[model samples]
Target: MNFLKSTYGAMMLVGLLAVSCNRDEDMQQGTDTEEEQAVETSSEGEDASDDALEMAYQGEHQLSVSGGRVKNTLCATVTNDKVNKIITIDFGDGCVGPYGRERKGKIFIAYSSEVGDSIANRIITFGDFFVNNKGVTGTIELRDVSINADGNLQSTKRLKDLTITFPNGQKVVYNGSRTREWLAGAGDDDPTNNKYKITGTVTGESTTGRSFTQEIVEPIIADWSCAAQGNFARVSGVVEMTKLNGYSVRKRTVYYGDGECDNVITITTFRRTYTITVDN
Candidate 1:
């Protein structure tokens, strides 16, 4: 599998949270900005985010890259205040999907919210984040990144000092940035009409001179009814994969959720449907 196609679900599914927190700007001064590497012994810590966002994060989002399905668990809590929170998503230990792909990682995101002068709302930006997927460890630097008062994520995400180790012992180093947004729908009223959709644009290259631009297709709506021990259930409308290597649109994928805490999803792409079984 190619790079984008392989990691597509991981990046795209998480982008679903780009929607705003009620469109009202939450501005604060001297917001507690600190990174606590200490994993709280208790799964439950503090509280943060609005109901919609809180439910989404606490539940967590995961995507299996191929026909084979995978399950993961998510844990998110306010370490201190609303601005400061910790989100951890575990994709399990060496889960296998398709095309000889096996991944095991726990993505940890620590962020603080502050008002921004320009660009995004500067509501909640990441102070430090590490993504481990398929033996790839990427440290994320979110600078001036904010989900605007409008709830559209407005910031440039810089991935620095990234090293992905292949099963064969070969490693690739990459650094890149991805800007995200909430495309359509505002609230959680109607999934068909008021879907909380989000998208992103990634423009970055690897140390090996592999330059890439990815335009992430937004989902139709978001589902946040299920929240128990970081078990999330989501159904995406349709997604597009734009490979900028030669500027071509590759695949269009759609999702259908069972709307149950069972965490199973039906993924459709190019007239072929794949049943993805997600678990906590």
Candidate 2:
């Protein structure tokens, strides 16, 4: 009911937040090396993994669904009002990458099951989730959410005529189910368990004022490797996008990012064969 107002609120939030956060450095050198590495991946083997596009204001150096690590720019305060039976999570300021960029918002949810010191697989509906700061801004309605025993998130998000605007005044109206997971965990020196990796689908118009459907053929991999140094995370998969800037084309896309938390991930299509900067 309050989607449009919240969206505008989110946009305004970004407009204000953008002036505060420190800007990231250039990523050109990082891109070149990765491009060269991608060229060699086919002959070598499959990449480590894809990344998680879902952003939760959890902690610093959390594992991403894409297999990389995420540094939470905003360490949200989690408060549960026992009397009211409500859980309020404030995502103050943070970076959500492979996409959805940096965000600062809040989520209000109510759970049916008992939520203890630790929330494990607790099914909760009626979530008022909002994320916006720099790269992305939007509110997500939680239909149902349950975190596994392993602390991996499994949930369905609703986007009711939600609009996510890009830098060029173009917007994407996302309306669909965002089923998600915590793919990989934060691991340093090959740490085995943490939270990394996110996979799901949002179908709708690729840009504002356009109508079409796009379905990813498989789980698009968001790869954030284990290495502590270097800005390297990628989004790779085959998608059938019937309308992207008015083009009906289904192609495999591989996006390489500088891991700068800047929402800028490179796009490479068709069998690891080309490179294009984000929104360039």
Candidate 3:
């Protein structure tokens, strides 16, 4: 009788241990998924904002070159105030723009002077903007636009209270400052040739309520030609993302590849490294 009782007790102990181990594994998996989602969603938001900035600059350039005569374009309806140096672009109900992305609502740009002029500042705000069914709310201000020592045009990109809400009701908040340097194709009439290098640090709260900090360890290459060809706008770079909560602190290093125009990116986590093809 004593031997039987001891055996039964040991069996129960083993069962409880198994359940605890399984529960821990499940929690870890859940957290990993959340980290991935957070990075992905934040990246999407940044991409949309970059497109909007480019559009606004193009519109301003067109107006400046045309003596404020052109008001409408294939992408959106543009309106400008020459005296105030303000430009408003309304995408209206919805329209398919470059890269096969659907955008709607409006973008307002208040420029200190001509967009590329030295020391000029452009303050950009959104009005009910929706990109591919995701709502974006934020202020993106380009400050101190000037030519750098390398003969490249550069500006300080500031994002304030930028919030991106997914179609599934999840919201991600982003705030950061980045430096963008125009590397080439500045004089081209075709925007697809434009390229820029971006370096910055971003900290935000993910859709799953996890806070993370991102640092661009390598300057990210933003090539419009790649995006125009249905690829991700960011061609190459390395980003380190650190999650602030969960079972443990998670650090993810993302590699965008060696200047390839593909949508593939590899992410290295504490547990493993994985690749994902983004639908840009």
TM-score for all predictions?
0.35, 0.47, 0.83
Cα error, candidate 1, residue 23 (Å):
50
Pairs of colliding residues, candidate 3: none
lDDT of 2 at 71: 29
Error of 2 at 16 (Å): 46
Whole-model lDDT values for every prediction:
0.34, 0.39, 0.79
Q: Any runs in candidate 3 off by more than 4 Å, and if so which? A: 1-30, 69-74, 114-119
Cα shift from native, residue 91, model 1 (Å): 15
What digit string (tens of lDDT, one per residue) describes model 2 on residues 71-117? Answer: 23334455656576555545554444223333445544454443332
**Candidate achieving the largest TM-score:** 3
Residue 52 lDDT, candidate 2, scale 0-100: 13
CA displacement after TM-score superposition, residue 236 of candidate 2 (Å): 3.3
List clashing residue pairs in candidate 1. Answer: 20-151, 121-148
Expressed as tens digits, the lDDT of each residue in 126-202 for candidate 3 is 99988778787888888877899999989999989888788888787878899999998786667788899999998
Provide the global lDDT of candidate 1 against the true structure.
0.34
